[model samples]
Target: MFIRNERSIKEFIRYYPVVSTIIIIHILTWLLDIIPIGLFNQLYHLGVGSHWGLQNGEYWRFITPIFLHGGLTHMLFNSFSLVLFGPALEEMLGKAKFLFAYIGAGVLANIATFIIHPSILYSHVGASGAIFGLFGVYVFMVAFRKNLIDSQSSQIVMVIFIIGIIMTFLRPNINIYAHILGFVVGFLIAPLVLNGARPYYPPQYRKSYDDDGEIRFDPNRWKKKRFSRKTKQNFLWTIIIILVVIGVLYNVF
Candidate 1:
Protein backbone atom coordinates (compact mmCIF):
# COMPACT_ATOMS: atom_id res chain seq x y z
CA MET A 1 0.00 0.00 0.00
CA PHE A 2 2.94 2.35 0.58
CA ILE A 3 4.41 1.73 -2.85
CA ARG A 4 4.57 4.63 -5.34
CA ASN A 5 4.10 3.70 -8.99
CA GLU A 6 3.82 7.01 -10.80
CA ARG A 7 5.99 6.91 -13.95
CA SER A 8 7.16 10.53 -13.86
CA ILE A 9 7.12 13.69 -11.75
CA LYS A 10 4.08 14.89 -13.69
CA GLU A 11 2.34 11.58 -13.18
CA PHE A 12 3.20 11.65 -9.49
CA ILE A 13 1.71 15.09 -9.07
CA ARG A 14 -1.37 14.17 -11.12
CA TYR A 15 -1.91 10.99 -9.13
CA TYR A 16 -1.49 12.59 -5.72
CA PRO A 17 -2.05 16.27 -6.05
CA VAL A 18 -2.82 16.85 -2.39
CA VAL A 19 0.43 15.34 -1.19
CA SER A 20 2.29 17.10 -3.97
CA THR A 21 0.83 20.45 -2.97
CA ILE A 22 1.70 19.96 0.67
CA ILE A 23 5.32 19.18 -0.18
CA ILE A 24 5.49 22.15 -2.49
CA ILE A 25 4.19 24.42 0.24
CA HIS A 26 6.73 23.00 2.65
CA ILE A 27 9.57 23.77 0.25
CA LEU A 28 8.36 27.24 -0.58
CA THR A 29 7.78 28.13 3.05
CA TRP A 30 11.24 26.92 3.95
CA LEU A 31 12.75 28.98 1.17
CA LEU A 32 10.91 32.09 2.29
CA ASP A 33 12.04 31.49 5.85
CA ILE A 34 15.71 31.26 4.86
CA ILE A 35 15.53 34.36 2.70
CA PRO A 36 16.50 37.68 4.40
CA ILE A 37 13.52 39.73 3.20
CA GLY A 38 11.76 41.77 5.90
CA LEU A 39 8.19 40.77 4.98
CA PHE A 40 9.15 37.11 4.77
CA ASN A 41 10.66 37.39 8.24
CA GLN A 42 7.37 38.71 9.52
CA LEU A 43 5.57 35.91 7.74
CA TYR A 44 7.70 33.36 9.59
CA HIS A 45 7.16 35.04 12.94
CA LEU A 46 3.42 35.33 12.36
CA GLY A 47 3.22 31.68 11.42
CA VAL A 48 5.29 30.14 14.22
CA GLY A 49 3.45 28.27 16.99
CA SER A 50 4.07 30.77 19.72
CA HIS A 51 2.19 30.76 22.99
CA TRP A 52 2.15 34.57 22.93
CA GLY A 53 0.70 34.58 19.45
CA LEU A 54 -2.01 32.08 20.33
CA GLN A 55 -2.83 33.94 23.54
CA ASN A 56 -3.11 37.24 21.68
CA GLY A 57 -5.74 35.83 19.27
CA GLU A 58 -3.33 35.04 16.48
CA TYR A 59 -5.14 31.77 16.14
CA TRP A 60 -3.94 31.10 12.62
CA ARG A 61 -0.61 30.13 14.23
CA PHE A 62 -2.22 26.79 14.93
CA ILE A 63 -2.63 26.01 11.27
CA THR A 64 0.26 27.96 9.82
CA PRO A 65 3.02 26.26 11.80
CA ILE A 66 2.31 22.98 10.11
CA PHE A 67 3.88 24.35 6.94
CA LEU A 68 6.81 26.01 8.74
CA HIS A 69 10.06 24.26 9.63
CA GLY A 70 12.93 25.15 11.93
CA GLY A 71 15.57 23.99 9.48
CA LEU A 72 16.23 22.03 6.32
CA THR A 73 16.52 18.79 8.26
CA HIS A 74 13.15 19.29 9.89
CA MET A 75 11.40 20.02 6.59
CA LEU A 76 13.11 17.24 4.66
CA PHE A 77 12.28 14.59 7.24
CA ASN A 78 8.64 15.56 7.48
CA SER A 79 8.27 16.01 3.74
CA PHE A 80 9.90 12.63 3.10
CA SER A 81 7.55 11.01 5.57
CA LEU A 82 4.62 12.58 3.75
CA VAL A 83 5.89 11.42 0.38
CA LEU A 84 6.49 7.94 1.73
CA PHE A 85 3.10 7.47 3.39
CA GLY A 86 0.69 10.21 2.37
CA PRO A 87 -0.17 8.90 -1.11
CA ALA A 88 -1.77 5.65 0.04
CA LEU A 89 -4.06 7.36 2.53
CA GLU A 90 -4.80 10.06 -0.02
CA GLU A 91 -5.82 7.36 -2.47
CA MET A 92 -7.80 5.28 0.00
CA LEU A 93 -9.69 8.10 1.69
CA GLY A 94 -10.02 10.35 -1.38
CA LYS A 95 -8.69 13.92 -1.51
CA ALA A 96 -11.23 15.71 0.65
CA LYS A 97 -11.31 13.21 3.49
CA PHE A 98 -7.55 12.75 3.52
CA LEU A 99 -6.97 16.51 3.55
CA PHE A 100 -9.40 17.01 6.41
CA ALA A 101 -7.75 14.30 8.45
CA TYR A 102 -4.27 15.69 7.82
CA ILE A 103 -4.96 19.38 8.45
CA GLY A 104 -7.44 18.67 11.24
CA ALA A 105 -4.94 16.58 13.10
CA GLY A 106 -2.30 19.26 12.71
CA VAL A 107 -4.53 22.09 13.89
CA LEU A 108 -5.81 20.13 16.84
CA ALA A 109 -2.29 19.14 17.77
CA ASN A 110 -1.23 22.77 17.86
CA ILE A 111 -4.24 23.62 20.01
CA ALA A 112 -3.37 20.85 22.38
CA THR A 113 0.24 22.04 22.44
CA PHE A 114 -0.94 25.51 23.39
CA ILE A 115 -3.16 24.18 26.17
CA ILE A 116 -0.41 21.97 27.58
CA HIS A 117 2.36 24.54 27.34
CA PRO A 118 1.02 27.93 28.34
CA SER A 119 4.40 29.60 28.77
CA ILE A 120 4.63 32.64 26.50
CA LEU A 121 7.98 31.57 25.05
CA TYR A 122 6.89 28.08 24.05
CA SER A 123 6.79 27.54 20.29
CA HIS A 124 7.28 24.80 17.71
CA VAL A 125 6.96 24.04 14.01
CA GLY A 126 7.04 21.30 11.33
CA ALA A 127 4.48 18.77 10.00
CA SER A 128 5.56 16.00 12.41
CA GLY A 129 2.25 16.23 14.17
CA ALA A 130 0.24 15.78 11.02
CA ILE A 131 2.57 13.06 9.84
CA PHE A 132 2.05 11.33 13.14
CA GLY A 133 -1.65 11.72 12.50
CA LEU A 134 -1.17 9.69 9.34
CA PHE A 135 0.58 7.08 11.43
CA GLY A 136 -2.42 7.08 13.73
CA VAL A 137 -4.69 6.28 10.79
CA TYR A 138 -2.43 3.41 9.79
CA VAL A 139 -2.35 2.17 13.38
CA PHE A 140 -6.14 2.08 13.45
CA MET A 141 -6.24 0.16 10.20
CA VAL A 142 -3.64 -2.32 11.43
CA ALA A 143 -5.58 -2.89 14.62
CA PHE A 144 -9.22 -2.76 13.53
CA ARG A 145 -9.28 -2.79 9.73
CA LYS A 146 -6.72 -5.45 9.07
CA ASN A 147 -8.28 -6.35 5.79
CA LEU A 148 -7.41 -2.96 4.37
CA ILE A 149 -3.63 -3.32 4.77
CA ASP A 150 -1.48 -6.31 3.99
CA SER A 151 0.52 -7.89 6.82
CA GLN A 152 3.85 -6.71 5.43
CA SER A 153 2.76 -3.11 5.21
CA SER A 154 1.25 -3.37 8.67
CA GLN A 155 4.59 -4.54 10.04
CA ILE A 156 6.36 -1.65 8.40
CA VAL A 157 3.93 0.85 9.89
CA MET A 158 4.31 -0.52 13.41
CA VAL A 159 8.09 -0.54 13.23
CA ILE A 160 8.34 2.96 11.87
CA PHE A 161 5.84 4.24 14.44
CA ILE A 162 7.85 2.85 17.31
CA ILE A 163 10.98 4.40 15.93
CA GLY A 164 9.22 7.72 15.48
CA ILE A 165 8.02 7.79 19.06
CA ILE A 166 11.46 6.94 20.32
CA MET A 167 12.99 9.66 18.22
CA THR A 168 10.47 12.18 19.50
CA PHE A 169 11.91 11.85 22.96
CA LEU A 170 15.50 11.64 21.80
CA ARG A 171 15.58 14.47 19.34
CA PRO A 172 16.31 18.02 20.47
CA ASN A 173 13.90 20.94 19.95
CA ILE A 174 11.06 18.47 19.39
CA ASN A 175 7.40 19.09 20.12
CA ILE A 176 6.33 16.09 22.12
CA TYR A 177 2.85 17.35 22.84
CA ALA A 178 2.11 18.03 19.19
CA HIS A 179 3.35 14.63 18.10
CA ILE A 180 1.33 12.69 20.66
CA LEU A 181 -1.79 14.80 20.31
CA GLY A 182 -1.73 14.64 16.54
CA PHE A 183 -1.48 10.85 16.66
CA VAL A 184 -4.35 10.57 19.11
CA VAL A 185 -6.49 12.87 17.01
CA GLY A 186 -5.77 10.89 13.87
CA PHE A 187 -6.63 7.57 15.50
CA LEU A 188 -9.83 8.98 16.93
CA ILE A 189 -10.95 10.35 13.57
CA ALA A 190 -9.92 7.31 11.52
CA PRO A 191 -13.24 5.48 11.72
CA LEU A 192 -15.20 8.47 10.51
CA VAL A 193 -12.96 9.14 7.51
CA LEU A 194 -12.20 5.54 6.66
CA ASN A 195 -15.82 4.58 6.28
CA GLY A 196 -16.31 2.88 2.93
CA ALA A 197 -12.68 3.61 2.09
CA ARG A 198 -11.02 1.30 -0.40
CA PRO A 199 -7.54 -0.17 -0.52
CA TYR A 200 -4.99 1.77 -2.55
CA TYR A 201 -4.25 0.48 -6.03
CA PRO A 202 -1.29 1.51 -8.17
CA PRO A 203 -1.77 2.91 -11.64
CA GLN A 204 -2.70 0.37 -14.28
CA TYR A 205 -1.40 -0.04 -17.82
CA ARG A 206 -3.75 -0.48 -20.73
CA LYS A 207 -3.82 -3.61 -22.83
CA SER A 208 -2.83 -3.72 -26.51
CA TYR A 209 -4.10 -5.91 -29.33
CA ASP A 210 -1.96 -7.61 -31.99
CA ASP A 211 -2.81 -7.44 -35.73
CA ASP A 212 -3.72 -11.13 -35.58
CA GLY A 213 -6.66 -10.27 -33.28
CA GLU A 214 -4.97 -11.55 -30.08
CA ILE A 215 -4.83 -9.37 -27.04
CA ARG A 216 -1.29 -8.82 -25.71
CA PHE A 217 -0.44 -7.57 -22.26
CA ASP A 218 2.78 -5.88 -21.24
CA PRO A 219 2.80 -5.99 -17.48
CA ASN A 220 5.39 -3.25 -17.37
CA ARG A 221 4.74 -1.17 -20.44
CA TRP A 222 4.35 2.06 -18.46
CA LYS A 223 6.65 1.15 -15.60
CA LYS A 224 10.39 1.21 -15.90
CA LYS A 225 12.52 -1.76 -14.89
CA ARG A 226 13.45 -1.47 -11.24
CA PHE A 227 13.50 -3.38 -8.01
CA SER A 228 10.51 -5.57 -7.24
CA ARG A 229 7.74 -3.82 -5.34
CA LYS A 230 8.60 -5.68 -2.16
CA THR A 231 12.26 -4.81 -2.58
CA LYS A 232 11.38 -1.23 -3.33
CA GLN A 233 9.32 -0.93 -0.16
CA ASN A 234 12.11 -2.48 1.87
CA PHE A 235 14.67 -0.16 0.28
CA LEU A 236 12.49 2.83 0.95
CA TRP A 237 12.19 1.92 4.60
CA THR A 238 15.94 1.31 4.80
CA ILE A 239 16.62 4.77 3.44
CA ILE A 240 14.22 6.27 5.96
CA ILE A 241 16.05 4.47 8.74
CA ILE A 242 19.37 5.75 7.46
CA LEU A 243 18.04 9.26 7.29
CA VAL A 244 16.78 8.94 10.83
CA VAL A 245 20.22 7.89 12.01
CA ILE A 246 21.85 10.76 10.17
CA GLY A 247 19.42 13.22 11.73
CA VAL A 248 20.16 11.90 15.17
CA LEU A 249 23.90 12.10 14.60
CA TYR A 250 23.67 15.58 13.15
CA ASN A 251 21.76 16.76 16.16
CA VAL A 252 24.17 15.11 18.55
CA PHE A 253 27.29 16.58 17.00
Candidate 2:
Protein backbone atom coordinates (compact mmCIF):
# COMPACT_ATOMS: atom_id res chain seq x y z
CA MET A 1 0.00 0.00 0.00
CA PHE A 2 1.06 3.57 -0.62
CA ILE A 3 1.73 6.14 2.06
CA ARG A 4 -1.39 7.97 3.23
CA ASN A 5 0.20 11.41 3.44
CA GLU A 6 2.70 12.97 1.06
CA ARG A 7 6.15 12.47 2.52
CA SER A 8 8.34 15.53 2.60
CA ILE A 9 11.05 15.28 -0.05
CA LYS A 10 13.64 15.79 2.68
CA GLU A 11 12.23 12.93 4.74
CA PHE A 12 12.17 10.72 1.64
CA ILE A 13 15.78 11.51 0.70
CA ARG A 14 16.93 10.84 4.24
CA TYR A 15 15.42 7.36 4.30
CA TYR A 16 16.28 6.24 0.76
CA PRO A 17 20.00 6.56 0.20
CA VAL A 18 20.17 3.15 -1.50
CA VAL A 19 17.51 4.17 -3.97
CA SER A 20 19.33 7.43 -4.67
CA THR A 21 22.67 5.68 -5.03
CA ILE A 22 21.28 3.22 -7.56
CA ILE A 23 19.81 6.07 -9.58
CA ILE A 24 23.15 7.86 -9.50
CA ILE A 25 24.87 4.72 -10.76
CA HIS A 26 22.43 4.55 -13.67
CA ILE A 27 23.07 8.17 -14.66
CA LEU A 28 26.83 7.85 -14.26
CA THR A 29 26.84 4.81 -16.51
CA TRP A 30 25.19 6.80 -19.26
CA LEU A 31 27.45 9.85 -18.85
CA LEU A 32 30.60 7.75 -18.65
CA ASP A 33 29.92 6.33 -22.10
CA ILE A 34 31.36 9.62 -23.39
CA ILE A 35 34.70 8.94 -21.69
CA PRO A 36 37.34 6.93 -23.54
CA ILE A 37 38.71 5.00 -20.53
CA GLY A 38 36.21 2.22 -21.20
CA LEU A 39 35.23 2.04 -17.54
CA PHE A 40 31.55 2.16 -18.29
CA ASN A 41 31.99 -0.28 -21.14
CA GLN A 42 33.80 -2.65 -18.83
CA LEU A 43 31.04 -2.46 -16.23
CA TYR A 44 28.46 -2.94 -18.97
CA HIS A 45 30.26 -6.07 -20.17
CA LEU A 46 30.56 -7.38 -16.63
CA GLY A 47 26.88 -6.81 -15.98
CA VAL A 48 25.43 -8.41 -19.13
CA GLY A 49 24.27 -12.01 -19.63
CA SER A 50 27.91 -13.00 -20.44
CA HIS A 51 27.09 -16.55 -21.62
CA TRP A 52 26.05 -17.18 -18.03
CA GLY A 53 22.79 -18.91 -17.29
CA LEU A 54 21.57 -22.00 -15.41
CA GLN A 55 24.17 -23.96 -17.35
CA ASN A 56 27.10 -21.52 -17.29
CA GLY A 57 29.73 -21.20 -14.57
CA GLU A 58 28.99 -17.47 -14.14
CA TYR A 59 25.63 -17.88 -12.53
CA TRP A 60 25.76 -14.40 -11.00
CA ARG A 61 24.45 -12.99 -14.27
CA PHE A 62 20.98 -13.62 -12.93
CA ILE A 63 21.48 -10.79 -10.43
CA THR A 64 24.18 -8.60 -12.00
CA PRO A 65 22.04 -7.86 -15.04
CA ILE A 66 19.62 -5.77 -12.95
CA PHE A 67 22.27 -3.10 -12.31
CA LEU A 68 22.97 -2.63 -16.03
CA HIS A 69 20.74 -0.69 -18.45
CA GLY A 70 20.88 -0.78 -22.26
CA GLY A 71 20.32 2.94 -22.82
CA LEU A 72 19.44 6.33 -21.30
CA THR A 73 15.70 5.79 -21.61
CA HIS A 74 15.92 2.41 -19.94
CA MET A 75 17.94 3.78 -17.04
CA LEU A 76 15.76 6.85 -16.60
CA PHE A 77 12.45 5.03 -16.54
CA ASN A 78 13.66 2.36 -14.15
CA SER A 79 15.34 4.86 -11.84
CA PHE A 80 12.20 6.98 -11.83
CA SER A 81 10.14 4.01 -10.70
CA LEU A 82 12.68 3.19 -8.00
CA VAL A 83 12.51 6.71 -6.68
CA LEU A 84 8.73 6.64 -6.72
CA PHE A 85 8.40 3.35 -4.79
CA GLY A 86 11.67 2.94 -2.88
CA PRO A 87 11.22 5.54 -0.15
CA ALA A 88 7.78 4.41 0.97
CA LEU A 89 8.90 0.80 1.19
CA GLU A 90 12.09 1.80 2.95
CA GLU A 91 10.13 3.79 5.49
CA MET A 92 7.76 0.90 6.10
CA LEU A 93 10.55 -1.66 6.28
CA GLY A 94 13.94 -0.56 7.58
CA LYS A 95 16.72 0.26 5.10
CA ALA A 96 18.56 -3.04 5.55
CA LYS A 97 15.40 -5.10 5.03
CA PHE A 98 14.38 -3.06 2.01
CA LEU A 99 17.84 -3.52 0.47
CA PHE A 100 17.60 -7.24 0.98
CA ALA A 101 14.17 -7.36 -0.63
CA TYR A 102 15.39 -5.37 -3.64
CA ILE A 103 18.50 -7.44 -4.29
CA GLY A 104 16.67 -10.69 -3.70
CA ALA A 105 13.91 -9.70 -6.11
CA GLY A 106 16.43 -8.58 -8.71
CA VAL A 107 18.23 -11.90 -8.55
CA LEU A 108 14.98 -13.82 -8.88
CA ALA A 109 13.88 -11.68 -11.81
CA ASN A 110 17.16 -12.26 -13.65
CA ILE A 111 16.96 -15.99 -13.01
CA ALA A 112 13.46 -16.07 -14.44
CA THR A 113 14.58 -14.09 -17.48
CA PHE A 114 17.51 -16.44 -18.07
CA ILE A 115 15.33 -19.54 -17.71
CA ILE A 116 12.77 -18.34 -20.27
CA HIS A 117 15.21 -16.90 -22.83
CA PRO A 118 18.40 -18.89 -22.36
CA SER A 119 19.47 -18.70 -26.01
CA ILE A 120 18.98 -14.92 -26.33
CA LEU A 121 22.26 -13.25 -25.45
CA TYR A 122 21.13 -9.64 -25.31
CA SER A 123 22.68 -7.48 -22.58
CA HIS A 124 19.98 -6.91 -19.97
CA VAL A 125 19.84 -3.89 -17.68
CA GLY A 126 17.56 -1.57 -15.66
CA ALA A 127 15.83 -1.70 -12.23
CA SER A 128 12.43 -2.77 -13.59
CA GLY A 129 12.62 -6.17 -11.93
CA ALA A 130 13.44 -4.67 -8.55
CA ILE A 131 10.76 -2.05 -9.00
CA PHE A 132 8.36 -4.82 -9.75
CA GLY A 133 9.36 -6.38 -6.46
CA LEU A 134 8.68 -3.12 -4.66
CA PHE A 135 5.27 -3.04 -6.31
CA GLY A 136 4.76 -6.60 -5.18
CA VAL A 137 5.56 -5.72 -1.60
CA TYR A 138 3.27 -2.73 -1.77
CA VAL A 139 0.39 -4.73 -3.16
CA PHE A 140 0.83 -7.52 -0.65
CA MET A 141 1.13 -5.16 2.29
CA VAL A 142 -2.10 -3.44 1.27
CA ALA A 143 -4.16 -6.40 0.15
CA PHE A 144 -3.58 -8.28 3.38
CA ARG A 145 -4.39 -5.17 5.38
CA LYS A 146 -7.01 -3.17 3.53
CA ASN A 147 -6.54 -0.23 5.88
CA LEU A 148 -2.91 0.09 4.81
CA ILE A 149 -3.61 1.22 1.26
CA ASP A 150 -6.15 3.95 0.73
CA SER A 151 -8.47 3.85 -2.25
CA GLN A 152 -6.74 6.64 -4.16
CA SER A 153 -3.28 5.16 -3.91
CA SER A 154 -4.50 1.72 -4.95
CA GLN A 155 -6.12 3.26 -8.03
CA ILE A 156 -2.90 5.06 -8.89
CA VAL A 157 -0.88 1.84 -8.74
CA MET A 158 -3.44 0.04 -10.91
CA VAL A 159 -3.22 2.84 -13.47
CA ILE A 160 0.56 2.60 -13.54
CA PHE A 161 0.44 -1.16 -14.02
CA ILE A 162 -2.04 -0.82 -16.85
CA ILE A 163 0.18 1.72 -18.54
CA GLY A 164 3.16 -0.57 -18.19
CA ILE A 165 1.20 -3.42 -19.78
CA ILE A 166 0.13 -1.18 -22.67
CA MET A 167 3.70 -0.02 -23.20
CA THR A 168 4.90 -3.61 -23.17
CA PHE A 169 2.58 -4.49 -26.06
CA LEU A 170 3.45 -1.34 -28.04
CA ARG A 171 7.23 -1.41 -27.65
CA PRO A 172 8.76 -4.21 -29.72
CA ASN A 173 12.10 -4.10 -27.89
CA ILE A 174 10.58 -4.05 -24.41
CA ASN A 175 10.90 -7.30 -22.44
CA ILE A 176 7.30 -7.88 -21.40
CA TYR A 177 8.09 -11.41 -20.31
CA ALA A 178 10.72 -10.22 -17.83
CA HIS A 179 8.36 -7.59 -16.43
CA ILE A 180 5.51 -10.03 -15.94
CA LEU A 181 7.74 -12.67 -14.41
CA GLY A 182 9.38 -10.22 -12.06
CA PHE A 183 6.03 -8.85 -10.93
CA VAL A 184 4.68 -12.30 -10.24
CA VAL A 185 7.73 -13.37 -8.28
CA GLY A 186 7.78 -10.19 -6.26
CA PHE A 187 4.11 -10.45 -5.37
CA LEU A 188 4.58 -14.04 -4.38
CA ILE A 189 7.56 -13.33 -2.11
CA ALA A 190 6.41 -10.10 -0.43
CA PRO A 191 4.19 -11.80 2.16
CA LEU A 192 7.10 -13.84 3.41
CA VAL A 193 9.17 -10.72 3.94
CA LEU A 194 6.36 -8.99 5.81
CA ASN A 195 5.56 -11.93 8.06
CA GLY A 196 5.33 -11.01 11.75
CA ALA A 197 5.78 -7.31 10.91
CA ARG A 198 3.60 -4.99 12.96
CA PRO A 199 1.06 -2.77 11.24
CA TYR A 200 2.16 0.82 10.71
CA TYR A 201 0.62 3.69 12.68
CA PRO A 202 -0.15 6.83 10.73
CA PRO A 203 1.29 10.05 12.10
CA GLN A 204 -2.18 11.39 12.64
CA TYR A 205 -3.03 8.55 14.97
CA ARG A 206 -0.26 9.36 17.40
CA LYS A 207 -1.38 11.84 20.02
CA SER A 208 0.55 14.16 22.31
CA TYR A 209 -0.35 15.24 25.82
CA ASP A 210 0.22 18.24 28.01
CA ASP A 211 2.04 18.24 31.37
CA ASP A 212 -1.36 18.31 33.09
CA GLY A 213 -2.21 14.89 31.64
CA GLU A 214 -4.61 16.43 29.18
CA ILE A 215 -4.59 15.41 25.55
CA ARG A 216 -3.36 18.21 23.30
CA PHE A 217 -6.19 18.68 20.79
CA ASP A 218 -4.49 21.48 18.87
CA PRO A 219 -3.15 20.04 15.60
CA ASN A 220 -0.60 22.81 15.32
CA ARG A 221 0.86 21.78 18.67
CA TRP A 222 1.49 18.34 17.26
CA LYS A 223 3.44 19.72 14.35
CA LYS A 224 7.19 19.52 14.70
CA LYS A 225 8.04 22.69 16.60
CA ARG A 226 11.73 22.23 17.33
CA PHE A 227 13.08 23.70 14.11
CA SER A 228 13.16 27.48 13.69
CA ARG A 229 12.21 29.11 10.40
CA LYS A 230 15.82 29.95 9.59
CA THR A 231 16.91 26.40 10.33
CA LYS A 232 14.21 24.99 8.13
CA GLN A 233 15.11 27.39 5.31
CA ASN A 234 18.76 26.32 5.54
CA PHE A 235 17.78 22.65 5.41
CA LEU A 236 15.60 23.30 2.39
CA TRP A 237 18.48 25.01 0.58
CA THR A 238 20.80 22.15 1.45
CA ILE A 239 18.37 19.67 -0.08
CA ILE A 240 18.14 21.80 -3.19
CA ILE A 241 21.94 21.80 -3.50
CA ILE A 242 22.06 18.02 -3.14
CA LEU A 243 19.38 17.56 -5.78
CA VAL A 244 21.28 19.89 -8.12
CA VAL A 245 24.45 17.86 -7.65
CA ILE A 246 22.56 14.67 -8.50
CA GLY A 247 21.08 16.28 -11.63
CA VAL A 248 24.50 17.51 -12.78
CA LEU A 249 26.03 14.08 -12.29
CA TYR A 250 23.13 12.56 -14.19
CA ASN A 251 23.75 14.79 -17.21
CA VAL A 252 27.58 14.95 -17.25
CA PHE A 253 30.39 12.54 -16.44
TM-score of structure candidate 1: 0.88
lDDT against the true structure, each candidate:
0.87, 0.64
TM per candidate comes to 0.88, 0.71
Among all windows of ten consecutive residues in candidate 2, which has the lowest summed lDDT? 197-206
CA lDDT for candidate 2? 0.64
What is the C-alpha lDDT profile of model 1 across 129-237, one tens digit per residue?
9999999999999999997898878988998888889888887778999999999999999999999886665644435444463334567753764667678777867
Error of 2 at 35 (Å): 2.7
Candidate 2 TM-score, C-alpha based: 0.71
For model 2, the stretches where C-alpha displacement exceeds 4 angstroms are 1-11, 52-55, 196-218, 221-253
Top candidate (lDDT): 1
Model 1 ranges with Cα > 4 A deviation? 205-230, 233-237
